[model samples]
Target chain A: MKCGLVAADGAVLHRETRPTPRVVVDARGGGRAVLEALLETVVELGQKAAADGHRVRAVGVVVPGIINAESGIVSAENLAWAGTPVLAELKAAIGDQHVILAHDVRAGGYAELRQGALIGTTNSLFLPLGTGIAAAMVVDGSLVSGDGYAGELGHTRFVNGEAAELCACGQWGCLETVASAAALARRYGVRSGRVVDGAREVLELLAQGDPDAEAVWKEALAALVDALVMYTTLVAPTRIAIGGGLVGAGETLLAPLREGVAARLTFQRKPEIVAAVLGEEAGCLGAALMAWDSITDESGEQTV
Target chain B: MKCGLVAADGAVLHRETRPTPRVVVDARGGGRAVLEALLETVVELGQKAAADGHRVRAVGVVVPGIINAESGIVSAENLAWAGTPVLAELKAAIGDQHVILAHDVRAGGYAELRQGALIGTTNSLFLPLGTGIAAAMVVDGSLVSGDGYAGELGHTRFVNGEAAELCACGQWGCLETVASAAALARRYGVRSGRVVDGAREVLELLAQGDPDAEAVWKEALAALVDALVMYTTLVAPTRIAIGGGLVGAGETLLAPLREGVAARLTFQRKPEIVAAVLGEEAGCLGAALMAWDSITDESGEQTV
Candidate 1:
């Protein structure tokens, strides 16, 4: 995989491409083996980088689940690991170089705040509504990782009528179950028994004025708007950058979302809702920035 | 009214009591008259302090509705004023003294974070559920007033069945309309035609296991839990200090509220839910702290 290092000021200092070793998944070997495989990947990557005359100052690896950055541990339910010492493992693999580990969404938020739609804004929220929904916060010119567990916006319950869908996190009628890109396709598949390629087809059908598609799209938009309004009132960010697969619908998603949020606010400042800039590379870019920031000595005292 | 200056470290250095003058309210006098009366009260208080040999370095006056603390402007729908330059007026009255104006809820949050229940916690939220809902935030050991419009949590819409109650802010089914102290009494009064005193009576009835009171209390608790979950996910605070008239219910609100939040979380860390300290004095205390902080040449970073 190609590796690039970017600073918090959006400066790309280095770019290198190297073949990453294939990850081995062993269901029978259980959690310990999964940890071993991750350690192996880090060691392999380190050796390859060193062989190519690159000093691996810091390495950031993205994973699913609750991450406690302060303790350098990761708790990913899907990854079959609880309290994995990722930072320690990476440091051991790459010798004495600095290692920065963070949640993928937060890294993405850092990228957006520095070089994306949220550029120049001290207060902003980056929401990615893909297979799952989450948010990353940048406030007062710094990414907020409160106790290393912020930005879980997807799990917010949104109760509507007696009907409720169970979320992967075991909650009923969570915003993610109703508004994520997966949710859009899931709802359609459940109704028609036809598996669609992605949420884009449903968006296309809605654009063509299909009644079912329109209804589903409206429900998703309403759910997204409900979550955004709540967030806006709580944080009052200067802007909200929306990313992930659903955002590929472009103005179709943004226009209605802006109108919905505007109609709901009375005295609160309405944040500008726009598509994110970095797209798929957001997490990588943010990780690089986080690495650089961890190594640099800068005062973090600006107001948002 | 008596005045006491409470420092951010919970030190009450100055105390004085004065008779609060009654102000005439003329609904037909227009907004300018209300502004004039408010300014007159501020000027009188400032002059009295100055006469007493107090330096009167700064004044922090709080009001409801949307407030921009940086510019010291207030816009309240209930109050007659819109875009009232409160700090400028107060500055003019107390010549050469810096003036600080802020939303009442944000002030309460500052008080809680600095000298009350949330003391010693780095990340916490101060929610005052009164006539309307608002919040003050303390993140990473500092007060967060994003663009001076943060903490309007009450206006977040909650959809339940086919029924929607219009909020005073013109939004439908706002949490404030369902869960606030005023809402509890109003809902009970409308249903039984017997006016209850406040949320305290509702709590008393709920403790005795009155079916009607239980039903309404449960609904309010659920709504509150939903909002809390949303906040918890977004900011991942270490604690939440609940204040306002409704918090006077004490354990009746805290016990069930804690259980409700615990039941909803699958993987997220459950923050401590506690009642606010400083009681009714939180706003004034926070204002005094702000005044003292403004005069101090320190970095101005909050210590708690």
Candidate 2:
């Protein structure tokens, strides 16, 4: 877990990374271990912040899952958390601090919107091509929560016909199945009949003129272009910030998308495609920014 | 044009159909004729309402084109209106009344949301399969305008590969190219080598067991299913209200959509597919409702 103590003025005073416990699905109260780890991390971070002469007024916790806003429960496949009382657990761990629970991608997008590449955009998209693909859609200056059901752009189908593959989400031919970081590595292995380190090795192999790596990269690009075109046509975003692991490839990943979406569009407004600025710390920084915003909000004060 | 005056309590106080003046594109001040006709209609309607002991408060004007919120200009190709100052013109013609300009399809969706098929939905879609396809997206209990560029669902690409037909929107393989009412009639004529009257005739031929009608109908259904499934996966609406002339087919259209959307959905929430209740007069009613709401707003009062 990457976390930090951020001042109200958006300065990071302290930072730390902690190992997340492996979620055991078969163990009794399997999700409890994950929750406990999160609670410990937050509590320890709060203590460290205080030790450094800081007063914590609010806390923001973001996770990758469907966050039920009203019930304050979460359900994540990887975390083995099925409607776990996460908000209640957080309140129990840190008494009386203003808490905000949000989706990781949306929070990251919020940080980008407030301070990073996507600043000043009213309608924009923040897409992270990580191990799993998800989107944070900003519509008319607000992040679309859809009650935590929105921004599953990665799960939408893009690959068509026989080339379509079944996704981990039980859907056929989802964008995540072909375009995500994990998919790039997995598809490279299946295409080349050899295991590579990850998307990093795949990128290196492409740079070295490997045919298998080229094919897999091309496939991911095609699906991603299709997804972007569809999103542009439907939602009409003026800017899109591409982030996560695959964005590490830099111009190699962005150029094709810009060109392909441009070629496909006719009446729709073209979006400025840019790389995300914050990298891995985006989500953590966003959480802190949100917590600070909450503190200001609780005091019923406005900030410039 | 079907027009109506609706009471604040959702009652139809008055209704009528008026002949629209044919736009003269080559004449001096070409689009002005149509604008004049609309002005005359609104003025006459207001006079009639006052004659019947009703007080005029606000005016709502909706059209089938982009409504530029900032400039209050409209540019509809079919209407031969190119950046016409519509809102300003309306205010000049009907002085001192609060004027609202909206998209016609969006107005229909608003009516459906208020008192029709989507009465209680917070997140829903009002899709009309007419001569062209467009969507009125109700996300988080509010209609999403996307600055008038949004809700062109018809224009989104659906047909894949070599068989993709070019849509009038300049995009190839759009949902409207195959799934719209005009598409059904056009495709039917092309298939049977006999020009049919319209989609109504195509429906009749289907009932009579014509192979050509069955083939075209199946093709339309397939593309529509693709569009709906894609929308459901991306937006997560709780219900979908299908409107326009095509909904006249009733069960023949809705049952298949419900079944197909249900079958295609995996992790996404399944939206209830139902026929739109308000029919052709929905836009007019919605305009009045919005006008009434605006009056409430101007008076600083709340309405149920």
Superposed by TM-score, candidate 2 places the C-alpha of residue B254 at a distance from the truth, in angstroms, of 1.5
Candidate 1, residues A1-304, lDDT tens digits: the string is 4355443454555555544333333453455565666667666656655665655556666655778777788887656667778777766766776677788888888878877889999888999989899889877677788877788889887645565799988888888988998899989777767788879888877888877788878888988888888888778888999999989999999999999999878767789999998888888777776776666553321100
Model 1 misplaced stretches (Cα beyond 4 Å): A5-56, A204-211, A297-304, B1-3, B6-10, B13-54, B159-161, B204-211, B297-304
Model 1 CAPRI quality: medium
- Number of backbone collisions per candidate, in order? 0, 0
Ten residues in sequence with the least summed lDDT for candidate 1 chain A: A295-304
Q: Worst ten-residue run, lDDT, model 2 chain A?
A: A295-304
Question: Mind giving the per-residue lDDT tens digits that candidate 1 earns over B205-276?
Answer: 877887778777877888899888878877878899999888888888899889988887777778999999
Q: Across residues A231-285, which tens digit of lDDT does each residue of candidate 2 receive?
A: 8878889999999999999999999999989998988878999999989888988
| Chain A fold similarity by TM-score, each prediction | 0.87, 0.96
* Model 1, residue B278: C-alpha shift (Å): 1.0
* TM-score of chain B in each prediction: 0.87, 0.95
lDDT of 1 at B208: 87
